[model samples]
Target: MRKPQQTPAQATTPYIDALLGYRTRGMVAFHTPGHKLGKGAPPIMREVFGAALLAVDVAMAGGVEDTRESTGLVRRAEDLAAAAWGGERCFFLVNGSTSGIHSLLLGLAGPGDGVILPRNAHKSVQAALIFSGAVPHYVEPTIDPLWGIPLNVPAERVAAAVAAHPESKAVFVVSPSSNGVCAALDAIAGVAHQGGLPLVVDQAWGPHLRFCSRLPLDAMSAGADAMVTSVHKLISGLTQSSAIVARGERLGLQRLESVVKMTQSTSPQALIYASIDAARAQMATQGEQLWSRAVDNAEWLRARLAPLEGVRVLSDEVLGQDGVADLDRTRVTVSAAGLGVTGYELETALRDDYGIAVEAADPLNVLLNVTYGDSHDDVALFAAAMTDLAARRRGARPLHGAALPANWPRFTRQVMTPRDAFFARSEAVPVEHTAGRVSAEMVAPYPPGIPIVAPGEEISDEIAAYLSEAAARAMHVHGPEDLTLKTLRVVS
Candidate 1:
């Protein structure tokens, strides 16, 4: 894909320049952040964070611009970001994509409103349902038999869901899942618009998609009404940096901005804002070159690992299967099931033996994310580590009891709205006895963070047993009050 020509204005980082200017003025501190320009900071903090970083951690009010009046520096930066991402409006998020999801849900739907979304959505979407009292109409994503991972939701399923729930306020979906399987966004968006509903995408993992044509189509270009992307995920932004970009008239812009203000912090972190601003400029001017290199490195690693004994690296073979329209080359997903070891075992071996950590690992696959930040040397090191592990484990017997149960529940039966169950009086019950009861909490394996059982769902016996198995494997369970799964929170 040819790189888009960047305008001169895209090169300007207004908010970052303003923040740097403020840091250099040497103004006396009299407001919040008692650290007071690193003077009062402890020696340990100063040593680790350096003086320059500490000095620039200033408040938005009076530091970046006037508190009461609008200087439009931040607004101008957001304009560049929106244009770069093919959105009409963009709002920077300091609390990450989690907050962006919240704002999107709250802005679009109120209590009792129905939202059509995929069952494989991130846990943050479930949280949004709990916060907004929205009713979820789940569209189950196609499960890939080879990797035992959830793929994209088919457009037909979405259209069927929309038809079934005509009163639904909006439609939401996740594209380019954590493992890099992208949904057919254009077809899905067409169905969504034909149903007269706005398409909101949780594109937290595909922030760099718009910059590189080798990647899947971005949300805005696919005709989504609104979408959120985490700049920190696959880009040069600081941690917790994200942006909510929207286009088209289907969504109310004023309400969206109001909800963003409500969900975001009153005193947002200036550093995160500056990083978002600067990252946008970088991607706008140099993203094609940067992501192209990342894609090359990732493909090289995949090619090197594919020939190794008992190892399978996912590539173009996955395309045209399930609902996967395109693949992100920067994400190298490796399955070691043939090596007689689980992905968890492979991840641990790589980390402990080679001092190499991957982005995420499931029972069948380890997802390695290659970004502009990684060099060819970094990719080579990971490839070497994986090759060594595969060679040592060749001809070994398959690990018994390493796989999750085939009957492991993906989406449980929803008995009530998430908000109703979450806010209702609840009690703790033993995991074994909790089957057939209404769950008052959410439980999911971290990294992918898709809930196996969410609030208001009726806990089935199969789900209960799966939780026990997940716990036994020491999978980092997220969102449940009882991390051990010994007890589950259920509605009274």
Candidate 2:
């Protein structure tokens, strides 16, 4: 007997359609609106930007969903998200995770305060340092020798950082790095709370984690004071959708909201707002069923790729003692180590040659982010492509004659505040000659996207070499240096 195929009724289309038609009962706006729906915006508001933007800017005149104080649709959406993730409060974000991150940091820190951050963090956090005028102390995460990826910072590092900076305001971490390496969040939170500091985590790729047990624990459950998640990264929301999920009152929601308002657009897109509302509703309604499909698809892909030569799938082998909580199976991280080509090369070939776009391309690994939208057949196609790629690059010479270094130049020495150096008087000079000057921009490797030389750090000769070698291998680096590393931007 043949197994029954899944039905289309189980499709996410119905829920998505419902969200598309979501209605806010507010007035159509007429005073400021030329069409005159009779709402509360300036007369020029519609003319300055466009009618479409202001058309959706209706207030909760009668029965419309209110967003400011949250009564109808907004409250419902947030309640749905809160219940889905076990968070007490979940607020939608108009801008990307950048806005959410800045808000969280400002809520917890201020001038003269110090924050503990992982050395390998998004440049946005460093930017937050300038906005809030908070000093930052660094913590380096563990390196996985076999895969050549940076794992999560251990709990001990957070503890050490907090202890060293006794006045630290918050413990910040990125769980399940962009490469899919997770940290022990529970322990990290314990350390933060013990030190009387709230824990702030950036879990941008983990919106689906709450629905599935196979994934690692999300920031909210780990007792983090607040977390910022980008739904566009992995969830089914539009490209710029994100949210700030709080686990407690320590983060000061009022202050966070003010910051969010300041950074976000006054005339928010109803389309984006509706999408978030629908995403929240979907998760609230059938998260388990959808998330299970995504997980199963990823696992099926992992199993198929295991038989290929030079293709290694990380299991417990990649995770160290108390190093990671659980692997996000959805993010399929395949190390191209010993496969004769850098992940950057594979990424280009995959997209250009095979028409497959990977989530990220790095020197050692390619990250393929799977989501609820993809099916088992999609993963099958990816696995087949990898099989061919493995065969093609086997005899290719490495970009660097020597194998990847067993160790990287340690991230030592912080000379100035990242914020000051970024906005200060700076010059663009040759990379080779930029050794002593403080960097004025970020030079980050792709897969991790963490800055080795951020705006305020002094670049080392060893750090420069790792990047040049990586570029030779076709790795795409972002920020000041143009991947070639011929020139770097620096503070004059």
Highest lDDT scorer: 1
Question: What are the RMSD figures for all models against the true structure?
Answer: 1.5, 6.5
Q: Give the Cα error of residue 202 in candidate 1, in Å.
A: 0.7
Pairs of colliding residues, candidate 2: 25-64, 26-64, 28-37, 29-37, 29-38, 29-39, 30-36, 30-37, 30-38
> Candidate 2 on 197-243: residue-level lDDT in tens?
88888998787777565667777777888888887787777778888
How far in Å is the alpha carbon of 448 misplaced in model 2?
Answer: 3.6
TM-score of candidate 1 versus the correct structure, residues matched by position:
0.97
Q: How many Å off is the CA of 189 in candidate 2?
A: 0.7
The candidate scoring highest on TM-score is 1
The residue-by-residue lDDT of candidate 1 on 1-492, one tens digit each, is: 543566878899988898789888987888768898888899998999998988888888856764313777778888899988888899999999999999999999989999998999999998999999999999998887777788888889999999999999999999888888888899999999999999999999989998876777888888899999999999978999999999858999888989999998988888898899899999888888888899888888888987887888888888888688888888888878888878788889889999999899888778989998999999999888878887788798765555665233756688999999999999999887888899999998886889889999999888888877777766687998989888889999
Q: Give the Cα error of residue 69 in candidate 2, in Å.
A: 5.0
- The lDDT, on a scale of 0 to 1, for candidate 2 is 0.71
TM-score of 2: 0.84
* TM-score list, all predictions: 0.97, 0.84
